[model samples]
Target: MVVLPMKEGDFIKIEYDAFVKETDQLMDTTHEEVAKEHDLYNERATYGPMSVVVGSGTLIKGLEEALKDAEVGKEIEVEIPPKDAFGDRDPKLIEVFPMNRILSLPEFRKGDQYPAEGMEIRINNRTGVISRIFAGRVRVDFNNRWAGRTLVYKFKVTELIEDRDDRMRALISSVYPHSEEFSFEFGDEDAVDIILPDIVKLDTNWAMAKFKLISDLRKYMDLRTIRLIEVYMKREEEEEHDHGSEHSHEHDDKAPAEKGSEGEKKGEEPSENKEASTDGEEKADEKKE
Candidate 1:
């Protein structure tokens, strides 16, 4: 059986090693050893074949275009020009900020030291690196690190995913890359259900993250319902009771009634004796009359 060349809308997993063409600096790789050597080892990251939707912007334009005719199990080394890779570096992205302005950021405190050169900082919702600091001013560069540099990638297609389960897994991995575990259920009516791990459910950004994940998944698969399930065990919380003082007050109120009942019982014999004496006097007076 002959496998067709990769085309748009196909999902493929590939093992790739990328480098800067000019400097030969390793930019990215799937191999664990290479990542360790480059001090980029992330224990949480999945250091293996990565999934990509062919026409999706999951990859740079050049790399995605190269995969159009790529074959499985065959290594291909492609050189991408700066224009097609990260784009030419623009001087406009390098802006200067006053020392006072930099100090006024939310991350900075009144007595905190100002950011130094080579430090990354967020300003106006954009992240930039401090390239220079002098004369009460700082230069922040917002350009991509690889901008104005060509990129070289050696990659091979490891697997072509067609199974619905694998495709769903790929979609999840793309969105929640560091997710621990998740399961999927497809119904007869084209509805989908995803059971996320407990850890993911605890994320603070879960509301926004879930929305983006569902949006990305819908781009590839049509579904009537997508249920994202997160189950959590509720901690047994003890209800705070303020009835201690109230109960004591109730006991105090009942004490008078209890004492009155005891007094009535104690006085019953004297009252009966007095009534008997009165009845005898009345009978003696009637006989005398």
Candidate 2:
């Protein structure tokens, strides 16, 4: 049992499946094995532990209050209404941006969701571009993408590790799965130095994923930064001698050549040459033994 004190606004890591409607229908799943999924944010978006400011608008009022004094290892169900959640989608929320403006940008394509400068939006996975445009304001409705939809979240508090360094490691590992040898060191309590094996090549996007993983943590305590340290891979030495040679396979077929110049005449008789070849092969086998 975790008897640790859980004060208001204390950071906690939880694994939650966000679903829609009553019973339980999870729409997004967290990849963390311990506890790190969020119902409000979509998958293509940056994913990490959902940080709730205890009783802030970061989440619904019900959830902020529920986390207080919450016991670790206990599962809790939270239901948020449209008012508490994103609220009903007002018609004004969906206005059209300029058709030309939308087409000019690279990300404003079908299937991609891009929010206005100050607006928040979640992609619905339904691919579509601006089909209609009315005004110069480029009628873009800037509403919470999930507005008008009720959400249910089932969460289990895996831990509440207050140590900054420990939390940094946990956060980084969630995004990047490492199975091989590695080492870690801290930088003045604000960064984690990771020594990944040289043999493991990380793709560019994966590297950026790691960078963004740290970026989310920066929103919290400005606590630690994740850095890559050079780790020399240990190469196992190969032994030259074979310890077990109980059984051997050697076919005595081709005879050894006589030691003479390429143009030397065949001085020895054919019988003598055959006898010399046999003696040389016997000596070779003896050397091997």
The clash count for each model shown is 0, 16
Per residue, candidate 2 scores C-alpha lDDT tens digits across 1-289 of 6753455445567666667785455565454432233334443454445433333244465555556646788878877777777688877546555546664555656636653444332334322223244554444445555677788877767777677656555555545545225466676756666776553465555677556565655655464566766655444432212212212212222213333532245555666888999999999999999
Candidate 1 structure quality by residue, lDDT tens digits, 1-289: 2264777778889899999988888999999999999887888667889987787678899988888667888789999999889999999999999999998887776666668888889998999989999899999999987899999999999888989888888877776655548877898656898888877756887777788778877778766579988777654452224356677789999999999999999899999999999999999999999
Regions of model 1 farther than 4 Å from truth: 1-4, 104-114, 202-208, 236-289
lDDT of 1: 0.84
Task: Give the whole-model CA lDDT for all candidates, comma-separated.
Answer: 0.84, 0.56
Q: Would you estimate the TM-scores of all the predictions?
A: 0.74, 0.44
> After best superposition, candidate 1 residue 33: deviation in angstroms?
0.7
Candidate 2 Cα misplacement greater than 4 A, ranges: 3-13, 22-24, 29-65, 83-145, 162-166, 173-183, 186-191, 196-226, 229-289
Overall local distance difference test of candidate 2: 0.56
For residue 186, give model 1's deviation from the true position in Å.
1.2
